[model samples]
Target chain A: MKNSPTKNQISSYIIQSQEEEIKRIALELHEGVGQTLYSLYSGLQFIEQTINSSNMKSYVNEMSQLLEKTIQEIRLLSVELHPPTLTTLGLVPAMKSYLRMFTSTYGILVDLDIEGQEPNLTETQKITLFRVCQEALGNVAKYADTHFIQLDFLFVDNNLTMTINDNGKGFTVENEMQRSSGLAAMKERMNLIGGQCLITSEIGKGTTIDVLLPL
Target chain B: MVMDNLYNQTYMKQACEQLQGTIECDFVGLAFQESKGPNIGWKYASGNSNDKYERITLRYGKGIAGRVLSTGRPMEIKYFPQNILGKALEYPIMLAEKLLYAYAVPILINGIPKGVLLVGFRSETSISDDEKKFVEKAAADIKKFLSLEKM
Candidate 1:
């Protein structure tokens, strides 16, 4: 008789499929729509230069500006969906770029500190770490209502520990865990990879999340 | 170029107020792509409970305003959070305003959709066809106002 998968196994399968779908959509947005918009922008610029009538030229200029905005929007969306750097440059660089964009978008200052060299990690490990940070940062942006954050990456011995701290209005961790799926997802992601995700927060104090993965 | 001189926040606020009153809705908002910025944001609102909408910036195809701008069509949600395609949180305006129903129409400029005019109700009430048409007409009027300033 064939054995049925356990609950944890089913959830892991779902998470993996979700990541794959996100990657596919990101690729379509970047390579398909992004390229098409770029060509349209170039085509409009060519027409703007070739057109003789001032009225027509101004109209083309407006169209070009709209297309430029659309292209930028698509680029940002695609990157946020699935950063290309995460696959090519590894975790540290990918997190750095994502934090930069996050700061620009939300006006939150992230003080990122690293200790020791980045340990070699499996592809799943790298993505899992990146996603945990992404989810934590997103929650901070949405609910923390703070301007400053601290991110620490410590690679010591055979373990990689990442700490995210926010100086914001915090909530009761237990209540939030029950109320928010984002928090649950972060914990589930860490558990799936044999890692630990610790979240501690008080009502008036700030929040801190520590993720530790054994290498 | 000409937009810099004619972009009036007061006019937008007043338009939003008038639309809110006309539709008998709890909230009315106008979201547009700033000429100098790549993102879309709610610039004007009427009957807003809080100013949180100002902090929300949406990329194209993300939220209601973004969806309308991209599709160049009107969108309606009579029962929000229920029977919706995406998460209720994705529609920040609705969530922030506690909106139960919403209708958004695109404001076109030079034959291209450039902005969104949204009317929302806090109560779960279905908008009549006449009300939808009124909102669309208001969007068209706003489009004309925007285009007229460019010339």
Candidate 2:
């Protein structure tokens, strides 16, 4: 092949391109679809207050409730496509806010412990870590049997380390690779930044994901 | 109330159902002004056999809806006469739906026509003056239903 790139290079390029597209679509959803929905809701409120029939009022009330839920869904979708704070606030605050959403939606409790000081990280590195964390938490919510999760961070020897542990019915790594692309995507995100990801799991036990990032 | 996709669909379905009972027509449809286009097409229709009406776009003075929308007036054809239309090629929806007679009520907001509500019958029949009044009132009510946007 002429000017051939490695498979890893192609995959990293794909990820970076996808992130850029996500930002564009997220803004469109928030501004276009989201605004139209807001206008509809406001329209319903006017009808509800002006109407005198109890039966019609009830019908209006039901539709208004549905609209409110829809507006929230769009807002959530826009935020998930690209978190606005991820770039400006850096990794920790972004992850912290993300974890709040993640736990509230999944109804799981996460105990996060930070050690040492926050290390200097490239924007790419920070985003990679955030994606890795996102993937790990998604896996936990999907497969974990336990309600509790543990997240630990460390900085030592010019390396930044993070672990995500879940008390879930751990699947065989080989079997999981065949079943889902989640782990592969996580590994790809880590590999793009020269980070190391170690996923350890055993049947009837919990799963642990440890990531080491050279600072 | 913020309109979401699902909620919008549900609201339209409900409105169409209510229109059927009030207008007592075989078909009930709503068409809104296209945000970027000068033409309008049926956006929602219930009691429709297929989506033919929704697909036909209408320009001002082009179809029955076009005339009503432009004039901000309600119109009705009591009989489905072959020669009632000015031109055969002008009304694609009439041919598509095979509507014998129909009524169009201009959904006006601030005396400006923003949309049109169309109801039709399959066969030639008279739309009573009383029934016509009801359809006109429904158009006014729809405006009130949309007034919350200003708030």
Most TM-score-accurate candidate: 1
For candidate 1, write residues B13-122 as lDDT tens digits: 78899988888899998888766755677777899876667766665675577688878899988787788776554566776677889999998877777788999988
Query: Can you tell me which runs of candidate 2 are displaced by over 4 Å?
Result: A1-3, A116-123, A155-158, A174-180, B1-151
> Highest DockQ: which candidate?
1
Off by over 4 Å in 1: A1-21, A31-33, A53-70, A96-120, A136-182, A200-208, B1-7, B21-26, B47-52, B96-98, B121-134
Give the Cα lDDT of each candidate: 0.82, 0.73
lDDT of 1 by residue, A21-72 (tens): 9988988998899999999999999989999999899888877877887888
Across residues A28-137, which tens digit of lDDT does each residue of candidate 2 receive? 78788989999999999998999999988977865675566567656656666666566667677777777765553444578888888777677678778888888898
Instruction: In candidate 1, list every pair of residues with a backbone clash.
Output: none
User: Tens-digit lDDT track for model 2 on B77-147?
Assistant: 65554656574334445544656788898987656676788888877775788988877877776677766
The local lDDT score (0 to 100) that residue A161 gets in candidate 2 is 93
Q: What is the lDDT of residue B69 in candidate 1?
A: 81
lDDT of 2 at B8: 59
